[model samples]
Target: MRKILIVGAGQSGLHLALGLRAHGYAVTLMSNRTPDEIRNGRVMSTQVMFHTALQHERDLGLGFWESQTPRLEGLGISVADPGHGRAVDWLGRLDHYAQSVDQRVKMAAWMETFAQRGGQLVIHGCAVSDIDYFADSYDLVLVAAGRGELVSMFGRDPARCAYGTPQRALAVAYVHGAEPRPEHPGVDAVRCNLVPGVGELFVIPALTVGGRADILFWEGVPGGPLDVFHGVTDPDDHLAVVLQLMEQFTPWEYARVLNVELTDPGGVLAGRFVPTVRRPVASLPGGGLALGVADVVVANDPVTGQGANSAAKCAAVYLEAILARGERPFDAEWMHATFEAYWEQARHVTKWTNTLLGPVPEHVERLFGAAGRLPQVADRIANGFDDPADFEDYFYDPERTDAYLARAAAASAWPGVRGARRIRGA
Candidate 1:
């Protein structure tokens, strides 16, 4: 069996590690944190998985919280006016539910399971310089560091990278006692409120350390009001500021979290990251190469919530490619080809995410406007979160968008759909 070393216990790295081990490959999963450390640590991410990604976990027998995690049945959007309250709002009901399971619980459980399955679990902090040692020992090294020294090893592919600087200063907090949706009390949808030029606020329901909780994610534009967290350590202080920001910008969300308390004393994460796309193969000092997986290769902004989903798909694709190689040597060529295959699927995700990060164009704005009343158009956009590749057929550019609008119009026979078909979706 070929030895595969996976660094970082993130969605991609751990998924591939476990998949390889199940298929009888020698796999080593290394991470800096233990189950106890991670479970008790500060919140790592507001990771919500769409239909396909959730299905991948189910197929891998990692559906540990499928029954407990809150269902994100809809994607709600409220375009807030600076002083006039909500200018426009609508809910896009997802055909299938998306779910968010706190990484603390998820990753810790995964680590414990990998160890039980006889996979080597190494708890050690790694660095860029450590790539050489890993490459020399394992037949192939997969880096899914998410963020750390291992990330720098993958040279930025300028052709693919969209931004030169951090797009949004992100702040996330996990809290219990948030008010449920007024209309559907039992439903926990991903409720997003956009303050046009300012930033975005998302309230995602997740299963955290204390069971089910809500994640308030703030994507503050540079120099914007939401860009408030600086050297903030106290969770109470963070939550207080988060509440203040929401009250000032998105008051409706403020009402939802009126008396909500932080889930953990340390459950606050704040920072900024430049969304980057890197070359899949990283060259070592001694001419060795390590393959990059998921975020290490393509890091998307959390605005679209594609980070975890894309990473899960990357693991699935790489596992299949490796198995198909059979007895072939794990050469540089094989690595490049394998990454290219994954990129074909990933490109759509990258493109869609990039489009959302920017300001909405006129044509796309109209689509959202129409979605307020049209169920078909709304559902397509909602379910698009699952298979972003479909956006290429309609949501990416003018010609395709027009084509999709036509189909949607003809299928509905509603005069409203006909008017929408005239203009394209972005």
Candidate 2:
């Protein structure tokens, strides 16, 4: 039996563990804290899993969505020009696209499934030290530690990479039951609003085990006097600025939940703005001859809300590669190629999303401007999420854009109007 040791009990770690065990591997999962402790203490982050990623979960028979996730019908996106206090709504829905799942719940589900599969899970904290790979102590050591010390092994040299300026600071707070304000009436769940120069804010409905509704505010802080808001020590004061900015930037309906309180007192829910960066994959001293599987190798910005989905997708791919090699000697070349394949698949999507969130590029701005004037164009953009390949298709293939744009233009024309003629004449 192949013995696999997984470090960190986060979503990625748990997913990989359950996957390996199901394949008949002997898996031992270790984490620093007990499951209950991690569940109760950790602050929940907003995670939106796309349809493709969900399919992977279902194929793995994880059954996470049957009970835990909130099915979201569509996305409500608003673009605002804060300086002029002008905002426009760009609404789109997918028949079967994405769902919001509580990170904590997802983690718990994976852990439970891993255990039921006869996988050994150890709660004792174990710090991994540098080791000789040829020693037959273990078959694989996978690291899924997020933002932990183990990441140092794969860390990149800062001097070699070109990093962009930090766009905006993000402050997230999980609050319970501040009723949706009038502007945000009948708000069933997730909403994203752009505050122009100020930044973008997302309000997502959270699913907690207690059935109490939770609110997550992802506020973007652009440079200037607004930068001071980043330093405010008081949560109330910080929240006030968020509300004021929202009210000024857009005609958003938001209810102030007077009774709502934060889950954390010290404001551990916050994280600062950081440029999105990816470290090139490095081959660890492992071939099938060596005992140790590569752990978490990818780190992405949460701006696109693809972190969880990407992690899950990568896990699935990695699982396939492992199963393919079977008991054969682990070929270092093949393992590196497997990692690169997943990275190549994910890079385009990540870049497209980051570009969208960063200062709107001219081409994108023009595209949106046209989309606003042309409903058909808007539909194509909206349906972009439904495309199986998503941004990947749009980014990697220049030809695909033209085809998509043509379809968009055609769809945008008002009923009875010839879109081809309209574009030809213009």
Candidate 3:
């Protein structure tokens, strides 16, 4: 049996371990944190798995859907003009094909399933250092070690990367028993608001276990923002500030939130700014290879919430290539080809998502503008997440640009308005 050592216990690492074991590979998954540590650790971001990712979960028979920390049937997108104190529900009840779960619960469930599948998981105290690979340590070593110092071992010149300005900082808080508005049942569970010039705020309910909800706020800080504890340090004071900010953005709807009491004293509220980076796959000296995956490969702004989905897709593609080359020498040529294939598949989605987060490109802006006026156009965009073929078109073929644009234009033009405009312009 071929032996494999996976260097991280994150989502990709865990999924890979399970996939390899199913294929009759002996795998030793190593991580720095134990299951208990991950379970009790502070919850970070929320992940909405696309249909393809969900299929992977089911294919592995992980059986995690029923125990999902939360489930959302639809998504709501709004644009808030904080300066005018007005919010427009730009897109409501869109994207019905996706579901979200707390990152913590998903991780815990994955670890449990991996262990039950006879996969060996070792929680070493810290990261593993450089060891002689050819010394017969293992047949293969896969590095899924996320974005950190661990990425440097692959030895690539950092100067070759294209870096962009840091995006806004994000602060997320989880609270329990937060009542919902009668008019907007479970609104918090699926709503995302783009407050231009400021940032975006997403209220995702039940993102954690025990009926807890997440209040995610992103602010575009070219430099940074003044430290404002949203009652995290002091409930009475921070709560006041958080409510004030919410009311300032969506007074008519969020006013009710001011009355809700925060019950979790130990609940999480934290912030950080993320810089976007993209680098080419680097080849190691000894015909071994090191390539970035997930956020490390293409760091996308969370405003689009496509990180987890993209990572899952990347892992799936990599797994396919590995299986295809069974027992083949893991040489530089094979590694380069695999990395190229993965990139080709992932580039389109990554670019589209990243562009959506940045100042909207003209084509995308036009699409969104038309979507606002056309329900069919809006539905197409929402349904695209569930249809991998549509996603591929959007990413892989620039020629489809006009087709998408035409659809948007047709949707945007009112009855009789198209002819009238053409006549007038002519």
Candidate 4:
């Protein structure tokens, strides 16, 4: 049996570990925290998995909280108009529903599942030297940890990296008592509020440890007014800061969060990370190579909310590569090939995400406005979250954007499907 050591038990690591186990390979999963520690810890991320990623989880029988999590049936984008509330607002129904289960609840449950399935679970804080020492003991060592000393083992690929600094100052708070969008009434949707030149506010429906909740996340442009969550430690203070920002920049969203309270004292996360793409194969001190997976290799800003989705896809890709290799040595060449296969899909995500982090392009901005008038346009954009490759067709180029819009407009003219003009005009 091939023995594999997977360091870092996030979405990718754990998924790959359990996957290899199901194939009868010997797998050892290493995590810095225990199940209880993770479950009882501060909220990790704002994740809403689209159909493809969620299907991958269900394929592995890892969708334990599927029924409990809110079914996000659609996605709405509201571009804030200075002091005037929303300038362009519309909701696009997704072809398939998306769902978000708090990482604290999901990861903890996954860790326990891996152990219960007989995979070796090691609770240890790993470092470069530690991976070097254990490199010879396993047939493969995959680094899924996107932070700490392990990430440094993989050098940064300057050509692949777009930004040298953090793009957005991120702050997330999970809370309850938030009302649904008045426009969409009983429909649950992910609300994305774009404040030109400032940042964005994303309200995601999720299931946390405390039950059904909402994640009010802010992606603030650095040095901007929204970039003020630096030293707020108290949960109430954190919640207060979040609300104040909402009240100021996105008052419409604030109306929905009026009586919201933290799901738990540990339901807040505030931090920032430079979006990076590191070399896939990391050279260990002891002459063994560790392959980087997911965010470790292609970390993009969460502005597009692709972290967890990308991680799930990476794990699936790596599992396929590993299974195909059979008894072949998992060498540096194989590592690069595996990541490249994944990158073919991930590069689309990286490009789309990086594009959103900067100033919105004229054509793209025009596309957003069109989405409000054309339901087909809005639905295409909404479902693109499931397969971002669709964006490459018309997202960047002005000619292609215009062509696609014409096509969507023509399609909307078909009988029984006239596009809804949903934007609220000032």
Candidates in order have lDDT scores of: 0.84, 0.58, 0.58, 0.91
Task: Give the TM-score of each candidate.
Answer: 0.94, 0.80, 0.80, 0.97
Instruction: Report the error of model 1 at residue 347, Å.
Output: 1.1
Candidate 2 residue-wise lDDT, 244-298, digit = tens:
5545554443445445566554322555534444343333554322222222444
Q: Where is model 4 poorest over a 10-residue stretch in terms of lDDT?
A: 417-426
Residue pairs clashing, model 3: 189-205, 231-238
Residue 208 CA displacement from its true place in model 4, Å = 0.1
State candidate 1's TM-score: 0.94
Off by over 4 Å in 3: 67-70, 82-87, 92-96, 125-135, 154-162, 181-189, 224-243, 259-291, 361-366, 385-426
Answer with 1 or 4, whichever has the higher TM-score.
4
Residue 407 Cα positional deviation in candidate 1, in Å, after optimal superposition: 4.8
lDDT pick, better of 3 and 4: 4
lDDT of 3 by residue, 1-426 (tens): 777777777767777788888898888887777776776666656566766777776687753654544555555556655464544454424443456666666777677777888888877743323423421467666677765665655444334323345565555555554556555565433566666656566666554554556554444444433235433565445555555666666564465465555434434555553434445344444545544555555556666666677667767776787788778766667666766776675555555555555654555545555556655555555555544335544433445555655654654556643232122111
